[model samples]
Target: MDIKSFIDSTYLKTAAQAGLDENQNQEVLKTFVNEAIQEGFKLIMIRPEMVSLARKIVLDTSAKLLIGTVIDFPSGNSTIETKLNEASQAITEGADELDFVCNYEAFINGEIDLVKSEILKGTQLALANNKIIKWIIEVAALTDQQIIQLSALIKNVVLTHFSEADYNAVFVKSSTGFYKTANNEPNGATIQSIIMMLENASPLPVKAAGGVRTYEDAVAMIQLGVKRIGTSSAKEIVHRRHNQNEY
Candidate 1:
């Protein structure tokens, strides 16, 4: 596949009700998508609120639009019913694909039943609309043991979600980009561990976000078996390789 098709570079804004209220969030997001497309990047990720607007804007363009509604965003504290309801609503709003941040607290606290149910419902909802499901398992909070354990369960989960023949596009994502710094990002080790886990998990793809802000970073994740990178710095990476004089 083309590299463009394999990357979901820009992901969603945190839910406003969830406390991330950037006044310029919408414009920043729109410009990010537009720039990504202009620079030949494909598959711009959009929030639930901006999904329809994204789809509308990119309808005439070749760039593929992907809508990512965080299930239990930032903190995976929402009840299973709320996550399911969110999934259904996002799909109804015209999402080409669904990236769900699976319930992390459940995983950490050994509430595997809760974890499984949320994933099952979300995947089912995503499939009901014929949308692709991308599961985000926040990697930073996990230890090596947890990572491996999650991957083992994800193996079974993916099998249940997609048959061997239908597993072509399943994605196991690394982070949600919740942590940041003044100069850079974090989570390379986390991403690497996730990739290693996925190697054992199944044939499903893996996506690495958070801290992947450069071409070298993108290439490193891709080398480690990440099929995608979810970052807001995609344009900067593209710029590093381009010269204005050449254009």
Candidate 2:
């Protein structure tokens, strides 16, 4: 498979999060965007503030790399209006995709209506702007049953409110690659979780983010039917695949 096309070359950390100054962080982001363009990855997933810069860099090149930004990232507790505002701003700044952290906490807390409403609103906004949307379910924070239920919930929302042509544009992504788990457990996409998501979120598509390292891991996810793999180690994964092919 052309693994590079399945990769969303990602760098979502902020200046504070990466323990670097603003200028230093911008330099890092610039390098990341340049490298992604050079490598011919499908997309560059970045923070909202960097969307304009990334868009500018990509435009300077002939690469068809899509620019994606997270909305209400890591935490999915933002109000529906807040999430929409953030998504709108990202779109205005030239983002081609918006990966919103879904309100899993509210869903687990029995606020089903609230979660459903946000999904509907968020999906609507993205489709209206002709952009792709993915709902990050943050799998590590939930139980197995919760994962299945939540994945199905997102699929239901999209299938019910949107047309079949729009199904490909909406995805049920696995994680934010930012959620913390107790005892340093796997805090990202696991084989089991991906299976659950794929089985339940079919027709809507699934993007396995987080904990997906190594070329083998990426291939495994793709084999199991994940449409995209989100990772900070995209270049390394591609290199590993090349080395394996040479041997």
Best-fitting candidate, measured by TM-score? 2
> What is residue 140's positional error in candidate 2, in angstroms?
0.4
Candidate 1, 88-182: lDDT as tens digits: 77777766777777787689999998888777777767776777777777777777788777766766776876667656556777777774334
Candidate 2 Cα lDDT to native: 0.94
Q: Give candidate 2 misplaced runs (Cα > 4 Å).
A: none
Residue 174: error of model 1 in Å?
0.6
- Model 1 misplacement above 4 A: 14-23, 60-66, 179-191, 243-247
Per residue, candidate 2 scores C-alpha lDDT tens digits across 1-247 of 7998899999999999999999999999999988887888889999999999988888887678899999999898999999999999999999999999999999999999999999999999999999999999999999999999999999999989999999999999999999888999999999999999999999988999998889989999999999999999999999998898899
